[model samples]
Target: MPRLMAFDYGTKRIGIAVTDPLQIIATGLETVHPKDVIDYVKKYLLAEPVERFVVGEPKQMDGTESQSAQHVRGFVTLLKKNFPAIPVDMADERFTSKMASAAMLAGGLKKSDRKNKALVDTVSAVIILQTYMETRKF
Candidate 1:
């Protein structure tokens, strides 16, 4: 079965995650620079079948779209234009970074390790994918 892929998009890095073929678990895949993300994804698709994409939708405390959302929208547009078949959905990203940090702490990561922004981004993508999957449970 095709897997579900999720990305935590940032100005510098895009963190990617993928679900198991059974769609039961979400795993961190990679973090790529924004300029290389499309090519990275293209190469990934050549190796694995992805059915849909989940993008983190940045929002403010008042539930309004965050400024960074515009950037995400642009990326989504390019994504659709590049891969017309895969569908893309956005999930609210509030508190994901904090959640990622808390998870890493709970997992016993050292303070220095937990401070790795790239790892945090990847973990945030995993959290996004997991939340999306939970909401869609049958």
Candidate 2:
């Protein structure tokens, strides 16, 4: 089976995560500049067969679309246009950042390391991928 990839899109950086071939485990891949997303995905596709892309959809507490949603939407459009074979989906990302921070704390990361926004973004991508995997039929 092909793998699934997740992206945590941010203004400055994007965190990436990927599932195993069996789609059982979601692991953090890397944090790359937002501008490099297309190139990164293309390179990844050359290296591994991925079937789907899960992007974190940021929403307000009341479930309204957040400003960042527009940016993600554009990214989704780009994905569809550039890689029509790979489907793109969205998952609610309400508190994934907070959860990532807590995870870092629990993992014994230093305060300085925990402050790294890129690290939190990467962990958030992993959380997003895991959430998608749990809710998926397969």
lDDT of 1 by residue, 51-129 (tens): 9999999999999999999999999998999999999999998999999999999999999999999999999999999
TM-score of candidate 2 versus the correct structure, residues matched by position: 0.97
Candidate 2 residue-wise lDDT, 1-138, digit = tens: 999999999889999999999999999999999889899999999989999999999999999999999999988898899999999999999999999999999999999999999999999999999999899774
After TM-score superposition, the amount by which residue 93's alpha carbon in candidate 1 deviates from its true location, in angstroms, is 0.7
Candidate 2 stretches with Cα past 4 Å from truth are none
Clashes of 2: 0
**Candidate 1: deviation at residue 129, Å?**
0.3
Clashing pairs in 2: none
